[model samples]
Target: MVSSSLFNRASKVFPGGVNSPVRYYTPEPIYFARAKGTKLLDEEGKEYLDFSMGFGAVFTGYANSDILDTQMEIFANPVPEGVVNEKEIILGEMINEAVPSMEMMRFTNSGTEATMHAIRLARAFTGRDIIVKMNGGFHGAHDYVLIGAGSGAATFGTPTSPGIPEEIGKTVLVGEFNHRESLEQIFEKHGNNIAAVIVEPIMGNMGVILPEPCFLEFLRDITEAHGALLIFDEVITGFRFRYGAYQDMIGIRPDLTTMGKIIGGGLPVGVFGGREEIMKNISPQGKVYQSGTFSANPYTMATGIATLEYLKKIDYQSTIRLACWIEDKLKPYEDMGLKVNRAYNMFTPFFNQQRVWDYPSAVASDSLKFMTFFRGLLKHGIYLSPGQFETSFVGPAHSPESVEMAAFKMVYTLENEMNESGNA
Candidate 1:
């Protein structure tokens, strides 16, 4: 009947009363019945202005009509299995046009699979075993990207999840983001053995931390100098920023790029693409093997194509304007010693005053204060990412008025709850 009651039922079968670890917070998680546009309806039929945006997966907003229409059309006319479809070609071409680095492409069911295969491709191509990842960058649930990851891992204070073999951990070398010296040290020690250096051009997992000026250039140069591939794990930042990948906007080109979230138009999909020479190495074509039963399923392909096409027609400047407006409203709270990081339409308000350039800075944020702020905002009909480490997203569906209201709620929460606890 209510979120609490539904959570009680969920706890019986699911761990921590939710399917995903990040979905469950201290007292309880809000169970949503449905979503439309920029609002979510919980089990109690209460509406909240949604800023989580399905963890950056719903950039076009919940239940976008164009994506839905394409989905319906595809389902009406089913295609035979083991046959390539037109939607796949159209979507891939659009993606390649937007991101020129994707000379070749492959589709998968989730971001985890795309990242995993991308790593494998790198190792096979370079004939090396080591993977160098940013300390707080989260690629996915896969073992290779889990070492010192952020997001739910950071939220739970468990950088290294259990059940992952010690051997897997050894292959991954973690370095601080925005700190070139840290990476240089790793390269000096194991440059010859490194297969690739994977990073998120703009970090979403560690709450929207931006890459410092020329930081991405540093990565590109170093990886090239080391004879290793540079992988941009753009799963969260991909279409959320632009129609293309975020790397393009930063003026850096990686050897490989992994994308998910927004491209699916709120469905489940992941794509990896890179230089033709590197992609040629993938199986049926080369030695490294990767395949999925639902790879580029017609349904997802159609929606992805529709989503990109629609995005190309819209003026994203308005969304950015609204985000800036929200940021302006929240600046007073920042003056009181809170750090707010914004990247395009997505942002995060870290409870710490210091700018979060790396994992240590991100971890230094006051988690308890964030919890209080989060709960207070929830009470005011604003939905935020449950985890402090995760980024909050706003889309075209979120109007200026809605954002202003959310910003007002944020300030109120900061003044009443955060200040009461001596956080502000």
Candidate 2:
């Protein structure tokens, strides 16, 4: 009732009563009054166990004290001088050390800007016009990166949103994730003109689909042979699994890396970096120009530094162990026709017979059934990402008791769905 009242009033000014498209859904979206650790309290004082983790952005947990303290200090001295600052320099150094591919780096206010600049940098460096992106691999909102986007775009069944000029979409080619032959065919058709092959190394946008054996290695080999830059968009994966980027874990260095979400330390931020030779093209160095007023705000920089420093101290294997425990609980549902795809601290359970590996297979999942399951889970005090295509994140804040509670809630919800369908 409280959420309904707020949604109705907010809808007058904002479309769908929410700032972000993904937050809106049927009935009404719950408005959280406050959140801490792994728990969120709604407007009506009802508490829910959070598994979304702010769409995998709050890796260090909600309202992390260390980050908040640093953020407060920066707020005391709000200086909007020129872009370059001490905090920015330190954060850049931190990023480069974590991701070796980032020989040099630049910061942006959001993931969309970082991705947009990455594409432009690739084009400038390679002197090519075409950009190849994996099907359902979401980069950002820019015209060049929007083609065949997943996440909310795929959830709404609109891969390429309207208003993006047809000519703009033409320069972007879509390749299948985890399918080597499909990429080979695309290369055969337009390899010469391609500038870069952009991808989410772990494919978080289309749930938690992972690369098959030698799939990443295949990407590295093919892109190198074709003389195209490989851009790993680790916006969701970066800092979520390990203290650094996922590319280092894969052992395949990308030419350029776009990162966001966790690196922001629960603030809004994005960063793109690459080899020094290729990065020199951006303004003040080369012809290609990119600038932003809030590119490296001191607040975001300080918080990010604290977040990464704290993450470095954390034992990532512990979080993964908890994720595995949760997955083990979901394994029983497999016999009842559910498929669970997992990678590190992320997982997605599909209502289909097959394991989802690509965009097409991901879309084949039963959304209606997922929606019912989602609503049921919410009633049981478990909050999940609303869309079936979005991946659920497990954080270090999720205690053993929290994992056990989530497992119980999940099983009970699944049983409810089965009973309602007369399959129990």
Candidate 3:
């Protein structure tokens, strides 16, 4: 049995015994001593091939030497007085160059702050009151973005949290993912009132549901027609799916885009940016205001610069190829009654009879079976995201050999689950 001493101590001081609700598991989270590359070594010295990948932030890998060196360099020579750090300047320039839609970018400490500021900018620019978000999509923990939050929110069975005032929740309209009709319904009713429509082009929070054909185009069309800004919350899909934003992959240009995870290079960072016209609405340029003391802290900028520079040199196609291989390897499991699926490097093996397209379907999956399979995989030295709604990430750290090992463990875990249930 794992020790509850750490968790027990944590519960006394921290809510739910974890700093982040998503990190909390049924029994308790495993305390890790350290992580290197694709592997995590727990406090008890148990090793597991980690697929969680810091919630898809550590795209380059854990403890990357290049990033560490850059971080050290930043530490050695603090920010020069009256001189902006070259790393932040370079990162901003690189992002603007790579994603043409983002003419000006402002860094934040996390995705929540990015979305919060983006929404504020949209409202200020458009002079509108309402914000539309997908029913199961998660933007971040802020009251405005947390409407119909997924992951821990779904697990708790409260689509919208209780602490938020009724006035705040009323402004957040929820639409269904992949269903343009639902969006149209919401838009037709309150199109003029909406300041912005924020969406995850590839729905990562709700189990990797890809947008239906022309769904993104419909969003662009409707939002444009209604004079509402379309904000693509690419916190998960920004750099992971492709070199630029996933919006580029789908051939749609969002008025504003919020990015986190990989952009931070495993450090705490978030960014929101878009056309110069809308961006000017923020801070010194316009009436709308947003700021953070640690927004562009030199350490995070250094790590982000190193990570993006390294990413520019990587063969993204090769990483996608490895993901495709893992997908192919798991295809057989679907025939065995497991609902295995993949979208980019995010993959899931759902123990359900039907496909999961939205929050309802996603929650209908067999959580108990997933829990069993999760324990089985853990026993076999493979780590997976603890919840059914969360996606299992594959990163640059996971090589073909490491993926093959994980595949074997997954198959064995499924087989064991089937056996115990007398379905094998």
* lDDT per model vs. reference: 0.85, 0.85, 0.82
Clashing pairs in 1: none
Cα deviation at 61, candidate 2, in Å, is 1.2
How displaced is residue 241 in candidate 1, in Å? 2.1
Q: Candidate 2: TM-score? A: 0.95
lDDT of 2 by residue, 116-208 (tens): 999999998999988888888888778887776323211211237788777786677777899898788778877888899999999988788
lDDT of 3: 0.82
Q: What is the TM-score of each candidate against the true structure?
A: 0.95, 0.95, 0.94
Whole-model lDDT, candidate 1? 0.85
Q: Spell out the clash pairs found in candidate 2.
A: none
Candidate 1, residue 387: how far the Cα is off, in Å: 1.6
Across 1-424, the per-residue lDDT of candidate 3 in tens digits comes to 4447888888999999988998987777788879998899998889999888888888888888868888788789877533466767889998898888999989999999999999999998999988888877888898887666324211211237789776676677877777777778788878898999999888887566777688889999999999999999999998896678888877899999999999889999999999999998787888889988888888888888888888877778777767777677777877565676688778877777787776677778887777778877877888888777788888777888888877877776776555554121
